[model samples]
Target: MSDSEPRMIEILRILSQQEKPIGSKLIADELNEKGFNLGERAVRYHMQILDEKGYTERKGYSGRVITELGRDKLEKGLIYDQVDFIYSKFEEMIYLTDFNYITQRGNVVVNTSTIYNEESINILKSIIESGLSVSPYVNINEDKSKGKIEVTTLCGTTIDGILLNEGIPAQPQYGGLLRIEDYKPIRFEELISYKKTSLTPLDAFSSPNRTSVMDVVTSGDGLIPANFRLIPGIGREKTIEIIKKLDKIGIGGIIAISDEGKDILGITVPKGMVGISIVGGITPFRAIQEQGQEIDIKIAEEIRDFNTLSPITSTIKYGLKPVEHTPQPKISFLLSKSWNLIQQVNFDIEKRKGDIISNVSYLKKEDLDKTLGIMEETYNSNPKYINPYYKIVNHPSDDNMVGIATICSLSIDGLLINNGIMSNPKYGGLLELTEPPLFIELISYNGSTVDPHKIFIAKNMTSISGNFGPNKILASFKEIPYIAREYAVDLLDTLDKIGFSIYKIGKPREVTYNAKAENYNFGVVAGSGLNSIAAVRERGVDIHVKAIEQLMPFENMDRL
Candidate 1:
């Protein structure tokens, strides 16, 4: 039968389904309901043609009914649709079962490049529908001249397990799907440059290679942290899954993902919320690593579970091990500058202070000595606070010095002196509760009024349990005063005449990130590395630096 005969056969099927003879109008209505959309006049014309062709016969006063010939034609049409569907399914099966290149023993060689285009994505969808785990990245060389795709599985046996289950004749050889080919190696620096130019937030976030060390220290042994919901995962679907889980638990907080998929830092749970931090960044991990600090097994475990809520209780249950932390050279310089600025500014302000914060008792030599002594004891005891990873130096000479120095600088600059930790003895009493006086508190105090902004303290500060003064607001590490990029640069410049570049600051510029699938094509431009970029922009410095800033504070902020 001709291709057009199939349309006529569809009409015959409608006639046979009816209990009695059907008119052309009724036949047309049925065809419309079935998506044929033929007009009654046209159906009537077709019925005459069917009669002449001997597939249909006219009944007494009734329009037409399917004869034996028509019934045969209708059956054939149904089989045709079924065969067409089976053909597509077979195509998918062939793609999944057969490999373009296989190992010597016929082990499947899965080319990651096969999954990037439209045709390949359809095959990938079929594979996923069979409940296979798919990784977001394929390690292919950046150079397009060599047509090779790198295959990476979450773990070994992922491919073999799937292939064996499908009864395919394939065996796992090496960890990767492909054997070594004549491919050019892409250097780390080149990759970074390529990513800087091309990678988007979504691409970076969804990339299988994107690995983040989540710090649950922010949220410990509590309900799922609110911040966890805000960070985006590999793609929209995965991100939606995270949002659904967080919403199911019934907590709300901001979680912004970075363009590079590196940093997911923000306040997840609000202040006073007793939840672990699901929001995290790897900057600190990288920072410490850059300084030759190896990630302890415990730290690595924490990183693995950071995105999920499983190990949160354990995080709170056990105290962290003491890891030696020395800031990077530039960071060290900034820390020294932060300390010197405080001392220099404080000395200059102490001499010309006519009238300062009302009822505020500035640190006397004895008080400074007493504060430093307390800090030294705390630092020696708690290694967590001893080597400030990303914040101010906790050394005896630098403890409480950055705050004091910032206050002095601001005071000398003629900014209004606010109620800082050093400005009031009660604040000192409040800070004294924390094991290490590594904490900084900044309260707003203009001539006759107090600023409505709550006093800023770290989320983990021991002083928050009704011990600190009333109206104290505990904030996350990112909310620290000097952690702001502009403020940090100012602080850095104040202490050291020689300037340093801030790598982790600024928003991510334009870039491309793609993840394509059937009925799905995600391309992020301005959206690339948003979470990572945001982490840098929002959190200011890197993790170690921000970690230090968490216990750090601002002085004379109103003046500055």
Candidate 2:
């Protein structure tokens, strides 16, 4: 590939991300941000070449847009020159990992795989329990529309990252098929050097027909994906210490570490270096694939906060339970229900003299016992969900009824309004569990009739139980004037002390965790008041939720 071709490919990539045509100057600026030194003139020259090659088309003063042909070329072209791509990418990810074994609070690399059926989840659980993967912790995401579940596991490359942080340099040598006997790694049957291929070697070799990971699980003899790495002999003891520390924290994948100039699983180590053999993180997905489950796998994709991951055993114990399918309500019925809700809310607002209302939701008298148990279980499983300032209260109207009051997220808007700061509710979204969590799915307030958080809960799209940090939860995004920065910060601190979950507050005119603010405005992400209720729903309890139902005095609520 020519130097110009790479630049042209990048230009096409930039154009692909835009909905409208972008001029050469903007493209040049973006390229510079990506560490490319291309100027506007050079970008214009590349655009001209791209136009000649039918890859891009000029859009009348708006600049150039990538054509269908360009997208196809970008997807299919320039493979031969990428032989060292995987090696470089692996190295980059290793260096990016900043997970500290002590605090367990930094980022670690992860591999994501998708399975279409619920039965496949059991296979994954078994693999995690059997210690065939990198770590006991995993992240799960559910897509009800597509009928698929995405599972994220710690990548073996994270070992390199941990070692790198400890002042040790580790080199990835090969990804291969390791033979296992009596559940012990014995040898590498086949190897693909990182320097020899553009594709990830483990990904290349993860075929249902080639690996019998499930058989190994049941019979203790089969071939599974593994990798080889090398580190200086001097760091061997330190590496062992790190491994033990990781084990204490429920993370492991290093199968064996060899001494100086020693061979591991028949792979010879270089002089002054020691060999390390690690089980592939994708082994569980490989097992699923061997069981005739269709899966899409991406190897060592990106770094995620270690705190966001939870022990796989926790998932097996509290993971999503299969629920019986119920017939969908007719559109007319839904519309009628929505209309009734709107009228009820209006009536309640009038009674409260336009004050923001906090909804009081009720649990069925019969379900009170089971539902409360689920809530307690959730709080025990992850202490982050514990809110000592909040608790269930007796129903106002009926002696036998039970009620729970959740502060409306809209109350934040009201608070800002009282302070002379205008606030606009923007979206209700599912925020991904990351260090600085971002919204993975969103429903705009302007486009929806029902509360988006309610919709997400009803659709069973939340995974709050498996891992507290990495699971998606209901959150709302609101925009406030940038000038209210100091005031808003003070208000948020007050809200926190009063028990509101404030996710983040953004800088002026910038996107906050994937939610964009309007000009001269900034964004704020607050936890949906219904998160605890959602947790109950996740545990298979059916509860009726009335959002922003009625206003109640804060002093009237009880503490848990």
Candidate 3:
């Protein structure tokens, strides 16, 4: 219900209430009357942008009228505003009230201001017992002072937009604070690789039976699918079924990033929705659909074929009025407050990893289950029932064997960490993945001994190279072995000779180098001895035998 963007809504609303085309001056005046204080010039500027954007129209110099796109924008704004209002009221109630005692799952505890009348308490009790969520609450302490009350609720009244499933609603909402007790996290070094095959919309429609606009755009190779469901006329029941099926296959919950280009939720899977079916050629029910324009399958397919950035491209080609930008909004059952729970859960998970060794192996399901059950019983018996965290891992023996590692952990932020679970006492405990930079370091060392700090030093070298150049330009730099400094210079010099471009070089002592012509640029730092060379490699510096030979001129000579 939050208007992530609000100004656009305000502009649309002003145009909606007017019958005839109104000039920007009048709109500005109306907004000023409503406390916006926008000058006519600024309003006119926004009006022109909106008109060009297709949200409004300039009719014969009369001014601007709300286009169908503008109306759609306004309608969505109202819905978000209403939802925000409800959530704000709920927050306000929690902030102001205090409860003397609060009970959850029959565990009663005292709080600051639990003085609500018996009837009010009972009303809440009924709602909770009926498997429905309640607004935020307050707790009063024994001293009649307020106590801490943490209230949470899921964002929906239904499961997959259905009030009932099999004649019963999904009560005891599944979207509450992720119970850390529910899942187990298995750790496997193999799962750490990012080569796993995952499903996408293209995969969904590439089969012989499916006909998606994505198929048309990429000649059945499948273009990036749009999240909007513009197909039209999809029945509620069918949508519900689709949602459940998608959930089972783990294809749902992907969110497109916001305009700010930050992924706050961390789930970065992209999704393309199979939009509403355009059956019977009736007007589409979606807000983005034009109010009176009849749409057939062809028009719907054309619209679906366009990507998010070019939403109106096909429509313009067809001489249709542009629709509002209608990318699918992120829909989540969990509320924002779950973020706090996620932080706590992640902390706990890190803490639990302290002494437990991770195992990576393919074991018979029964044997693996027995070992994990024993481990859980020994380590996590206090929490009688917890959720299992599925950690998918690649098998060491078989690249084709992908195993799910099940361990216990909390899933507050709607993501599951892959952990490998199979442990064999005979196979010498479990395998765990090292830190990301450490893994990169291992590769650079080429199975040779390298200090972990080499990776950090290498990354730091890259950072320094970005702003600082060779030693002459820097006023001061750390002093390291002279050989280490020479190694960096020789590496840069050799790279330039052997098809690599060297753009900059730092002083001989604290050697810093930047490469430009490679597929990717790399930086080198030369302060520490072997560690410095190792660090540069970890930081992505590719070296050749010629560079190594030049850097270590005495390598072929025997030591006295």
Q: Score every model by TM-score.
A: 0.18, 0.52, 0.21
Candidate 1 lDDT tens digits, 1-560:
24445467678877876778889888888878656878988888788889998899999787788899877655433332322323232223333332211221222212222112233333322222221222221222233454322222121112322233334322211010101011211101100100111111111122122221122223211111111221122233443343344333321121222332332121122222211112112222221222333221111010011111111111111112221122212112122223333333222222332321111112334344443343334324432212111112333453433222211112212111122212110011011222212112221111101111111111122221122221212211111122233443343333222111111112122111111111111111110001111122222221211111111232322210
Every model: Cα RMSD to truth: 27.4, 23.1, 26.9
lDDT (tens digit, per residue) of candidate 2 on 486-518? 988887777666556677888885557756677
Give the candidate number with the greatest lDDT.
2
Best by TM-score: 2
Better of 2 and 3 by TM-score: 2
Worst 10 residues of 2 by lDDT: 316-325
Q: Rank the candidates by TM-score, best first.
A: 2, 3, 1
Residues 238-305 of candidate 3 have per-residue lDDT tens digits of: 55554455334211221111222221211112233122210111011110011221211111111110
Of candidates 2 and 1, the better by TM-score: 2
The whole-model lDDT of each prediction reads: 0.27, 0.72, 0.27
Worst 10 residues of 1 by lDDT: 185-194
Q: The CA-based lDDT of model 2 is what?
A: 0.72
Clashing residue pairs in all predictions, respectively, total: 31, 0, 59
